[model samples]
Target: MRSIISFLTMIMLSGCGDGVTLYPAKGTILLENGNPVTQGTIECESVDNPKKLNASASIQKDGSFELETMGNKGIVAGRHKVTLIGPAGNSDLPLNKQPKPQFNTKYRSYDTSDLTITISPNATNNLNLKVVPAK
Candidate 1:
């Protein structure tokens, strides 16, 4: 009935119009020297809401990655500051330990990383980004 349809529409709109939307994004990560980065996690913090949202993905053996925002499929739609935390080849470390990152510390934070990305809604978001050894 029209009444039922209207109610359902209202429910859907309310959930989706909260000003945050995610978009599928995947890419390959290479080192500043042009080598494929074989292992590590790529994190993209939503410049719009850094304290609460982050999208991350693990680098595959071939260096390709598929990002997920807050465990959902895709990255948050907006500008983001990216960070590479590195060479974790595998998640084999104990909960209390972390693999040593090959890159320097300066590349780990938004303020320090010179890397940034912009993601728009409803677009094919496949993009590649390179990480450099911290200076």
Candidate 2:
């Protein structure tokens, strides 16, 4: 069981002095072709309770990210619906110079994404997830 509880967008932090330590979850995001996803945000939402505060992270240039819950970086012990939204690409560019969507709409939300992740009470959870572009 997780020591933390999340409701709506509110996060409550707790811990067990009995010895179970909850650690943060980290992962790397990559395109199906094995290239790094330069910019974007990743989400990890509780499966049973969609309203629970969702854990989110900024996708780094190396395609890596760490999930944050209750102000700390980690999720409670349970299943999570993972979602990734790639940056619109070249956001720094002029409006007309922005690039098209790098991935399909399905990759943008937990409800539509096929990605699911499980978090444990381990010291570290490093998931290597992959995303693909749709035709």
Candidate 3:
């Protein structure tokens, strides 16, 4: 009886580690003229419950990016709305006062007004977004 109880306890503890992991979702942004965009900011938000999850990352000089939110500080395992705010190139503006710039590749303003994504526990996931130029 004692051995059986101990075995069951171990099994239960193992199940507690279920969670999602995401990879370095990297991609490039370009202007409508076919020029590579070298500056911007990317952010992730939850679609189901907007206030539940949020994450962001800064674009690199080569137009590549990677974002990670893990160890209980990352997004929960589920769907999310991904949004990108291109760079305005204004260094004097306050952080809170800056507006989200539009992507200039395909002429679209943002990546997804209602983008959906899923996060799996104890795993790594990668995603890419190509933003178009604003009309």
Best by TM-score: 2
**Which candidate would rank higher by TM-score, 1 or 2?**
2
Model 1 residue pairs with clashes: none
Q: Which candidate has the top score in lDDT?
A: 1
Off by over 4 Å in 2: 1-22, 49-51, 88-93
Candidate models: Cα lDDT each:
0.76, 0.73, 0.56
Per model, state how many residue pairs clash.
0, 0, 13
Residue 110 lDDT, candidate 2, scale 0-100:
73
**TM-score against native, each model:** 0.69, 0.72, 0.50
Task: Give the lowest summed-lDDT range of ten residues in model 2.
Answer: 8-17
Predicted candidate 2 versus true structure: per-residue lDDT over 1-135, tens digit per residue? 243333422432343223333468888988889987777788887775445557888888898898886566677667888877666566579988875555567977777899988887754688898888645
The better-scoring model by lDDT among 1 and 3 is 1
For residues 1-135, write the lDDT of model 3, one tens digit per residue.
999999999876553243433333445555556655566766666555434556666777666666545322345556666666666645788888775555633222225354455665555655545556555
Clashing residue pairs found in predicted model 2? none
| Residue 129 CA displacement from its true place in model 1, Å | 0.9
TM for candidate 2 is 0.72
